[model samples]
Target: MAAGLLLLVCAGAVLYSAQAQDPYDGLPDDYKKGVDLAMEKLTLDPGVRHHFRFLKTLDKSDIESGFGVKYIYHHFYLKPTRCAKGSTVSNAQTCPFRNDRPLIDCAVCYKTAADQIESFPKPYVHCIQKPRLTEDTRTTRTEHCKKMNYNSGAPTLLAVSMPKN
Candidate 1:
């Protein structure tokens, strides 16, 4: 009787924890599962506050095991907001951040209940951080920030494959 009670209590605690982390009920089950899995798997340094914004669906596939969808999203590395020295106000425009310049493409896939996992090929062009302006290097290329000729458009699907389980 004691063992049975303990088991029941453990199961209830697990259920409660699961319910606490469940995403909005209105969201499709696949998306919720994918977000949860991604959140659980992806981790950065404790100091960096990162966010994942779903940009678009790259591709989708129906297989024998389950459905799989490839998604590209912005993984924003956020800096905590703070007022500038000697300034008493804080707003979006006044405050500066490292994320101002441009964004790049990164891809991830929904977790499927299958032996194989499908994902997009590795991106060729990796994102680079804007060069910081020091006293010496300020007069060089950093001056007059010229915009690159590329568009802020989503990447085309060049290749997709399923990794062996």
Candidate 2:
């Protein structure tokens, strides 16, 4: 058995298989299996898509299996929706946030790092991220400001009355 293993190793073929997923393409079979199992167990949301990359291993080779150990970063990107005017602040003159151009693509997807994950990362917002100096849309957080009562009493049909015996 040892002689056969030696022959296999001499062929320069690591523990990778042809049928492994694209993210685990170069990873060893055992590591791919583990990652696959782990990913299957993830509580992924409905719009989440499978996105993974092979990371470096703590050990270059598994001590038990003599195969290359692999690390992976796997997470799904949240699909961004079109910007809408949701802010209800009364003092704001113009709408906050980038309502001009929507995010065409995820910036993280084009980055060079293979093992980086962009799970639930906030997209570049114009008002928050690249706000103009003159735009007064950003809310100034105030600790001492009087709370504006939004609940100005809901509309009612009948007046309040005392309980009758």
Candidate 3:
């Protein structure tokens, strides 16, 4: 009877340990769904969005990728829009839009992932808008954001991308 009880205890302990060990357990399902939705939206603009995949367990990989993409998008697409009205707006900076400000900033939209992906760093996706310059006038540019990386991690682990549009 003692031996059977010991075996049962050992099995319970092993089960507990297995349940406690979470490789991608840090990421929540809701957050993962949000990321999926955002990625789907971005994929619609595949010509202008780049997706970079990375390992899920690493920290800051997704954030870094998101920031990098935000940097490129702001510089090429959003900045130009701000400058169109002869505003002396600085590039590669935070949002200039206030509650009363009429300007729409991409940083406001793209920065969401930076904070959300603090735990899992897998499937880090970023979009770079490649704008074509026309006649030295910078008008009539074709903006294309391409996926830089895709599914770049081990098959055993789940990689969650950032959810920001």
Q: List clash counts for every candidate, in order.
A: 0, 0, 12
TM-score, candidate number 2? 0.21
Candidate 3 minimal-lDDT segment of 10 residues? 101-110
* lDDT of each residue in 49-98, candidate 3, tens digit only: 23321113212212233332221111111222212222222431222322
Show where candidate 2 strays beyond 4 Å: 1-23, 43-61, 65-165
What is residue 48's positional error in candidate 1, in angstroms? 4.5
Q: Is candidate 1 or candidate 2 better by lDDT?
A: 1
TM-score per candidate, in order? 0.26, 0.21, 0.22
Q: Cα lDDT of all candidates, in order? A: 0.33, 0.28, 0.31
Top TM-score hit: 1
Candidate 3 lDDT score relative to the true structure:
0.31
Q: Which residue pairs in candidate 2 have backbone atoms (N, alpha carbon, C) closer than 3 angstroms, thus clashing?
A: none
Query: Candidate 1 residues 77-105, lDDT tens each?
Result: 21323333223322322444344433222
For model 3, what is the error of residue 24's alpha carbon versus the real structure, in angstroms, after optimal superposition?
3.4
